[model samples]
Target: MRLVAAAVTFGAVLATLSGCGSDGPSGPVDAGGAQGRRAPGVTALPATDPTLIPDVGERLQRRIPADTGQVLVVYGEGENSPDSTAVFYMKEGPEWQRVARWAAHNGRKGWTVEHYSGDDRSPVGVFGLTDAGGVLDDPGSRLPYDQDYVAYAPTVNAVAYDHVFDYVIAIDYNRLPGTVPHNPTRPLGEDRGGGIWLHLDHGDGTSGCVSLPKGAMKFLLRTLDPAQHPVMVMGDERELRA
Candidate 1:
């Protein structure tokens, strides 16, 4: 069965909080002076710390591009489980910091390293995040956004699949990058499957794409930057640890 392109909409307003604090020494300075000392209760990590992508094994971690500053990790519960978690991380200096995490769903049949057409399993490995689009208008996405209602509209189960394509980030798995998520140009051929995306969840697993909450989808659409060279690392927990 051909995979249907999922749609997603992003118009949710996000609130931001800022705090003001006085900048003065709260405690005594050490012998190295204030510049060398951390805040009273703060601890410092060495420059050579190597936990860049937490929970990811060496093999998968090495696949991440050296210049990539943003990473989305989809940790499936099991090889045959649809339930999973999606965590977003941003690179700060030499460390990777957790930004946000949300409950997510993968393919109905789970994950696979050898994904194919109609497999009902989300592909596992590192893939670039380059383009986005949906049936709705763009919501401040930093990546190239394509807004096509006709091409992105859900073809089956209209009521049940409504709003799934409101916001979508194309996962460059088997398709050409830099094109709209709905684009059908699969460089790896049709049998490998294509059109996999990170779209809004419809309370269940997808045919091949990964699904996230509406709020999470909106947040990702607005936050994932093309300049950051973002990539997604996805697989079951066990395989990710390998």
Candidate 2:
């Protein structure tokens, strides 16, 4: 199925974008079944980037080469298990193609995936192109005073024990207090994990934010077109997060 992209839209982000160009080819193939003409610097695609972890192969062998961003997340309704999805990121060169993959951490059962303070189970739905923050180089007033940050949520999550990356994005699929809970298309910090941005895995991993390798997360945060509306495909079931 075709993904729906994200919400943000910035045309002057000094981005090295291609898949969004007008001259690019699109639509269904002809009855004769002709091949697509690949772009000069950019290769022909089926929509969406290709380099995310979940888009790789079996096991955790994708960590070695380390190449994600401009990803193509392969998922659907039913369940949001790790294998249930295939996340692709950028690799090789400027061409956005699939490389790595992963089995996402979707919601478990009763508990929802929140960043602030709630049960630990990833959310389930399609997210828009969100922002990125870093607790490592943040200039905020809350936090441990000494702790910096860079997360998806410009303002949310009050705890400061450290999880993984320098950021965290609130997964919309929960019932928290200070946060927007789990609603689609809402801005950050709506509820609590609003401060949730993508970050590295510390050990305890995540509260709700998507936890990936530091390098992967960094590439994604930067690769995202600050002007385009990128989409996040997520869901979970049995073999997820295992």
Candidate 3:
């Protein structure tokens, strides 16, 4: 089933790439998913410096879809269109392997830069890594949250989650209660994606979470590692996937 899915996704990416489409992420590109302003009494940035994202010589890198989540999604960096081209890669044993690479889109609101506009870009920071398998256990979805998983979708919508291949990573940029820590080993706030999280993509532009086709998301969730202290790199097209 996995192999077949991979083949289908590859073909789709190829097809879409061959014929670029401009009907993915809608609205204006706002460039800000994080609330930005620190919450009262919240003195320090959540261990995640939005200004400085270091590739710990780790595994995966994403390009194509652009949005910050408690997860990181980049789009429009290459031949991939803002909504139709994207590739999610992870660093494995020795090299950064392409777990899943396919078409994607970004926000239609084009980065609303607000708490409600739904155009806010994904946030950049260190959030708590959580095991939402049970917490997020849903008969509506089949994501292996029971395993090692950390997501940051503050709210849930059926369009994005219902898709089989979609994986949504949220950013804690927006202030909220948030989920609990899955792996207690890492520094509490430093190990996870702030309010950010990697999640599935809805055909529509996202409020904050990085959205993608279903297949790309599944591969990401299943193959992600916490020890690497995974970092989601986001910014201008030139700075992010360099």
Candidate 4:
């Protein structure tokens, strides 16, 4: 179904372009500084363990709900780099298995623990993947899919953002779960920011959303199962390792 016209507007699309609306980090990296090293006091799963997700540390690792059987990791190249890689894993029996991996992009400025409006940084945390939508028709997603071309259209840099919203999976960060990806409700209050999603890559960094290739987006839409309780773990590699 289409989103209410009043709820989805060109202004909202603009807000998203600036890292606000439905699709929503930090600073420069210090090669020899803390940003370059794994966070202290955070233990990671043993590599020998089949469930181990490389580089994910104890802090974020513990945040993955025990019941969650699916995880998508967005590994950023650096604290200030927009480049990233995405890996999808599915729990198989007692072990997690890699199902797919794709090159991806994050916020133009990178990642952050405290994301705010217009920060142009994706949040660093583990968030549930609960909703899907886009300008295109549903691609057999297991999550609730909202299709509304007008609501999902880009209002700024139309040429550059063309088809970016053809598919999207809502990353539950500061947004109400089980709602449309474009829902403007922010339970954390507007200042905390919201609207972050996993969408089709436009060949560059996003304002805040994580962008992936169209093929990958379609793969995820068709494979991510609600019964698996998917969650996305994202941040710069070092932060994720912490």
Kindly give the stretch of ten consecutive residues in candidate 4 with the minimal lDDT sum: 24-33
TM-score, model 3 to reference: 0.42
Instruction: Assess candidate 4 and give its lDDT.
Output: 0.75
Clashing residue pairs for model 4: 22-195, 24-208, 24-209, 25-111, 25-121
Clashing pairs in 1: 7-164, 7-165, 7-166, 8-165, 8-166, 8-167, 9-166, 9-167
Q: TM-score of model 4 relative to the true fold?
A: 0.80
Best by lDDT: 4
Question: Which 10 consecutive residues of model 2 have the lowest summed lDDT?
Answer: 25-34
| lDDT of candidate 1 at residue 62, scale 0 to 100 | 97
Q: Which whole-number lDDT from 0 to 100 does residue 164 have in model 3? A: 19
lDDT of 1 by residue, 1-242 (tens): 11111001111111220110012111111211123323211123332344467678789999999878779888787898887877676665556655556667899999999999999999999999999988888867888999998877875676768888888899999988887788899888999999999988777788889987666666667667776689999998888879
Residue 7 Cα positional deviation in candidate 4, in Å, after optimal superposition: 41
Q: For residue 145, what is the lDDT in candidate 4? A: 96
TM-score of each: 0.80, 0.41, 0.42, 0.80
lDDT (Cα, 0-100) at 49 in candidate 3:
29
> Once superposed on the true structure, which residue ranges of model 2 sit more than 4 Å away at CA?
1-86, 89-117, 138-165, 169-196, 203-205, 237-242
Which segments of candidate 1 are over 4 A away from where they belong?
Answer: 1-50
Which tens-of-lDDT digit does each residue in 49-153 have in candidate 2? 333333222332232222222333423213422223235433333344343332232222212334344554445444444434455453231211223343223
User: If ranked by lDDT, best first, what sequence of candidates would result?
Assistant: 4, 1, 3, 2
